[model samples]
Target chain A: MGTTGGPGGRRVGRPRVSQRPDSGLTPRAELLTAAADLFTTRGYAATTTRTIAERAGMRQASMYHYVSGKEELLAELLESTVTPSLTYARGLLADDVTPAEGRLWELCRTDVELLCGGPHNLGGLYLLPEVRAERFAGFHAVRAELKDTYRQLLAATDAGGALAKSELDLRTDLLFGLIEGVILVHRSDPERPVSAFAEATADAALRIAGI
Target chain B: MGTTGGPGGRRVGRPRVSQRPDSGLTPRAELLTAAADLFTTRGYAATTTRTIAERAGMRQASMYHYVSGKEELLAELLESTVTPSLTYARGLLADDVTPAEGRLWELCRTDVELLCGGPHNLGGLYLLPEVRAERFAGFHAVRAELKDTYRQLLAATDAGGALAKSELDLRTDLLFGLIEGVILVHRSDPERPVSAFAEATADAALRIAGI
Candidate 1:
């Protein structure tokens, strides 16, 4: 088995440090999936780049093609949980045809599903102190923008319009709290389907909107 | 530099290692306060018993008289957050006079206030993987009991009674998730009065009830 192109058996770009069977499809994606698994399972600061690379089935040095260090991996993983939601939220904000209530409902449901959908509870990683560092400010800022989107969507609702200006921030905070808090519940009761959780939360979020 | 007693100060225990000047008062409580501060701020697994004792202004040896180890401190701190609520919930369950909805609102309001009332975000410690260990099962059990009370209260409500049997758990989960999720919001914006925060959440919880 030489480095050029070995026999068929889950070999990607460069040879792995010592392959231990993983869901070997795309090498880069596989590395990220492995990083997500380790960061959530083992404490973030405790996880080493060497260990992550080995788990991803690549030699530590060879893994640098995709990531500079654990920071890069951690940052990317954090972003994955929020970026899609933000994009969809922005689109929902811009879509003038849909009712604000409907848009907010979809946003809540999808956000819950996405937060719970990962094989690992990646949202749990938000608790790590390292996640508060400047390196993760990008993730934080994106999250803030997403929350603002929630605020705007809530404000646009007929019910939201009925409330005082000061009421919007408090309402958004409560609604967002419920949506994000689903991670902790799912972490303990993972048997529930993501779709079901999302629907139920969206339904509940409406109560907050009008309450 | 004497060991017996200090002249005119809040020192109520034996000598200290290094006087760092915490809110000098009851030694055991001061130790716990310091532990809560470090566990939430620096993180649980990272903080050491030695550091906790040092912050509380006691020798490591003296600190042992109150707590055997960090696990003991952690268990106590975790329990502190839930036991009072559990006690009140139990009383509310038996009261027979109060409406289920009102009782539920009071519980949510008080729980939020207590969670944010602490100098540190102790609920944030719930994120530590160590918290899920068997050693903290007592805390988990009490928390489960509290949630069960929420379920019972919800089921008793006219709104909750209208819901199908299957819907109760999902509703209880959403309401609870919002209640617990307030800790994360309060952590970032600790300036808001806990009383105001509680009132706002309890108000929002009613929406979930009817929604």
Candidate 2:
């Protein structure tokens, strides 16, 4: 989504399709879709905004109307993917009633679904070296928060256990790895159904955590 | 190491340091090391042969003596990392005396060691989108073989189990993911000892595989 007026508001970028109801997809959405395709395939650094515009069926100058630049396009794409997951994770962690194990499972399941459910392998974009730039700091911060949420859930689940803090943290890292690992698998074999991976990854996450 | 003339001969690239004596590192090793540093940090596409030569403290024309081009440098880097692991895996899988479970543990432990033992996060190179190109097919083939080794070991361990083939394959994928997951963790916190990650990943791999 394009940034609205505010200090911490979203950054300036093409408006999301949902922002405009009547039209099927705003030029911004088209640009984003094209950018994501190029970024995931040709890579962020290799794919120029001009190529992105061409792929989006727009003139290079007109493409600027939708996006400030390619970096903003990447930031928006990453934010769109990670922000929803962060929200879901925060929501899951907030519910104290559910056992920590169940909460962790739900988080893993939802994350796997998100990673594999998309038309494009959006999660693969995280592998890009450019994503580590200072411009994407906001995305990284949210990602860290999401990771912390996993650690907290894991620690809570291991409460009263003999597992040391260090060991618990390692397990938490492994759990995240297990969940994200599905993206690599999906990349290698996209023909497989997403639901199968989601279900299997959820089960594997619990097993890795020794739940 | 430079490829010898054979069916699977080494491709055109810098000669490894170990291949030479007296001199600490040959110009080829220097170029490859410099290229690896740049590729892992600055990225493959963004890095040029001139920059690689500069980083290696050599003239651009001299740099060509060691490597055919930037792509060859990347090929060598990937081959150096994956080939050794594949060799080790094949050896481990061929040992019929060891139970499949023990073999799997050994495989996981060794893989983790290789992944974390390096000065650079060599595994990080795999994250490059360029690795998917046809030129890097050999690397991908070796990688797939490595994965198959894991799958075979996993299946042997699960012999006669009620677990479906699909479930078994999924577990195999998760096991590989757990071991490779250490690279990402290592990337985030480089200060941590590699041995700790190696041990924890091996253990988590076993746990994920229900060993």
Q: What tens digits encode model 2's per-residue C-alpha lDDT throughout A111-195? A: 8888788877777777566777899998889878888888888878854145687887877778887777677777777888877
lDDT for every model? 0.82, 0.76
lDDT of 1 by residue, B1-211 (tens): 2344333343333344556354546777878888988887677767788888966777788889888899989999999999999999999899899898999999999899898897777887777777778899999999899999999999888999898877888888888888888877886578987898899999888788882
Which residue pairs show collisions in model 1?
none
The lowest-lDDT stretch of 10 consecutive residues in candidate 2 chain B is: B9-18
Best DockQ among the predictions, by candidate number: 1
Residue-by-residue lDDT tens digits, candidate 2, B36-72: 7888777778888877776565667877777889999
What does candidate 1's lDDT look like per residue over A38-85, in tens digits?
A: 777766666688878876777788788878888888889889999999
Tell me how far the alpha carbon of residue A99 in candidate 2 is from the true structure, in angstroms, after superposition.
Answer: 2.3
List the RMSD of every prediction in angstroms.
5.6, 8.8
| TM-scores of the candidates in the order shown | 0.87, 0.85
* Share of native interface contacts present in candidate 2: 0.53
